[model samples]
Target: MSLLQVSGLTRRFGGLVAVDGVEFNVAEGEIVGLLGPNGSGKTTVLNLLSGALAPDGGSIRFGEHAIHGLAAHRIARLGLARTFQLVRPLGSMDCRDNVIAGLAFGAERRWGSAAQREADDLLARVGLEGRGHAMPGELTYIDQKRLELARALALRPRLLLLDEWLAGLNPTELLEGIKLVQSLRQQGMAILLVEHVMDAIRSLCDRCLVMSAGKRIAIGLPGDVLSDPDVVRAYLGDDHA
Candidate 1:
């Protein structure tokens, strides 16, 4: 059975339909790429799945729970976690403290020295090792992204939603990020990745789900769907395809 099942998911903003009848499944330990051009509603879907935004319609099932319209904290407690397209770390808190917050609040809650230790370990895992005492503003953009990812992992989530997590990285950092995501999947974590870096999508995702204008356009293996005329047209325009 799929770890996550989303069907007929829809969301609206005034007159704009940001996500329209989108549907997909993410199996246990599978990494599915949410691919789309700008304004394709990929992040909107993430918001719906992670409970940052309630859907206007459709159903979301994570394991045994039907989670449509659940609050974000409740969803996190139920073993789903997400990182923002823009990294959000506590400005005043140090990196380790930020991760500790996640540890305290997530599904498998921890506290005291154990949480501290785990927080430090998470920082190390995401390559923020000795920078635990540094504030969010002290880190570079890419490091900030890593810090956010570390916090999400602290949730010990069954499914993770990453919104443009690999966006600002240089080539080398991008490779490391890809490997880190792969390691998580290896350890049995399911991931829904929203990324424009086609290299990472091709290398890390088990399957690709493409969207355009808030609608699902295609879903298939990376190579197959990426090459489809419809998919090509969605990204580069009618002339390119």
Candidate 2:
């Protein structure tokens, strides 16, 4: 059975339909890629699923619970966590404290020394070991992304939504990110990843869903979806395809 189920999901801003009748699912221990060119509504889908935006129609089920219009905090408490395309860390706080806050307020609500220890462990897991004392501004761009991942993990979510988390990484950092994602899957966390990095998609996703103009255009294995003529035309110009 699917860990998450989304059907007929739709959203709009004024007259623009950002996400239109989209559908997909994620199974436990699976990583599903949501791929599309810019303005294809990938991030908007994430926003709707994470409760940052309420859908105008359709349904989203996490396990047996209906999560369509719930507030973001409530959705988060239900073991759904996400990282933004633009990383947002508590700038004034040190890396460790930022993670600690997630532990203290997240799904489990762990607190005190226990939360601190778990935060440290998460930092190490994300390759931010021994950098816990540094402020967010003091970290490199990739390290900040790591910190954001650490914070999301502190929520102990069953399903994670990642939006463009691999966008600006160098080759080495990208490889590390791919390994980290694989490790999460091994640990039984399901993921819905929105990424422009084709290599990352090929390396990490178990299956992929392709979107164009707010609609789902294809769903299949990564290699097959990327090879689809429709996908090529949507990404590259028609002439190039």
Candidate 3:
């Protein structure tokens, strides 16, 4: 069975149907990309899967358990953790503290010491070596994002959801972020990424899914999906395709 499964998932925001019966499966250790233009329901899908918003219809299964209506904390405890588009580092804490908070709080097997050590290692891996004591305001934007990735890893999540983790970074930061995420996949983590940056998605994602007007329009290999006429027209216009 797929490690993460969503069948006929739907979510409505009053007059708008943000996610319209989207169904997909993510297997263990796979890196899947969720791509779409603004208001295409990519982030909405991540939010629903991560329990920040409950689904209006259908179901989600992480492993063998039903998770559609579980509370955020409850879902996290079930081996799922997520990173947000906007980094939410504790304003008053240092980088290490922010990551430590994730280890202590997110759903996962208890391993305080191991989690802290793992967090530190992850920081180093993401090129933030020895800057763990710096606060969010003190670090550069890239470092702040690196801390966010470390924080999520502290949960040792089986399925990790990342929403635009590279949105604001420059070219150099974007490259590093891709490497970080790809490295996570190598560590046997199943990842769901909602990304606007096509270059990153093309390079890091094993498979790509496109959404438009709150519905999935295409899903396939990155190269095939990127070149699809429908996907191109949705965001890049016909001439670009």
lDDT of each: 0.94, 0.94, 0.86
The better candidate by lDDT, 2 or 3, is 2
Identify the runs in model 3 with alpha carbons over 4 angstroms from their true place.
Answer: 108-118, 238-241
TM-score of each: 0.98, 0.98, 0.93
Q: What is the RMSD, in Å, between candidate 2 and the native fold over all Cα?
A: 0.8
Q: Given candidate 3, what's the lDDT at residue 120? A: 75
TM-score of model 2 (CA atoms): 0.98
lDDT tens digits, residue span 1-241, model 3: 4999888899998999999989899999998999888999988898998889999998999998999989988888888988888888888988877878877876554356776676677778778888877888998877887788888887779999998888888898888788888888988999999988889888888899889988999999999998899998998888887
In candidate 3, the residue pairs with backbone N, CA or C atoms under 3 Å apart (3 or more residues apart, or in different chains) clash, namely: 76-107, 77-107
Tens digit of lDDT per residue, candidate 2, span 91-146?
Answer: 98999999998898786798888888899999999999998899999999999999
Clashing pairs in 2: none
lDDT of 3 at 109: 44
Runs of candidate 1 exceeding 4 Å displacement: none
Candidate order by lDDT, decreasing, is 1, 2, 3
**Cα miss at 144, model 3 (Å)?**
0.8
75-175 in candidate 1: lDDT tens per residue? 99999999999899999999999999999998778999999999999999999999999999999998999999999999999999999999988999999
Deviation from native of the Cα of residue 180 in model 2, angstroms: 0.7
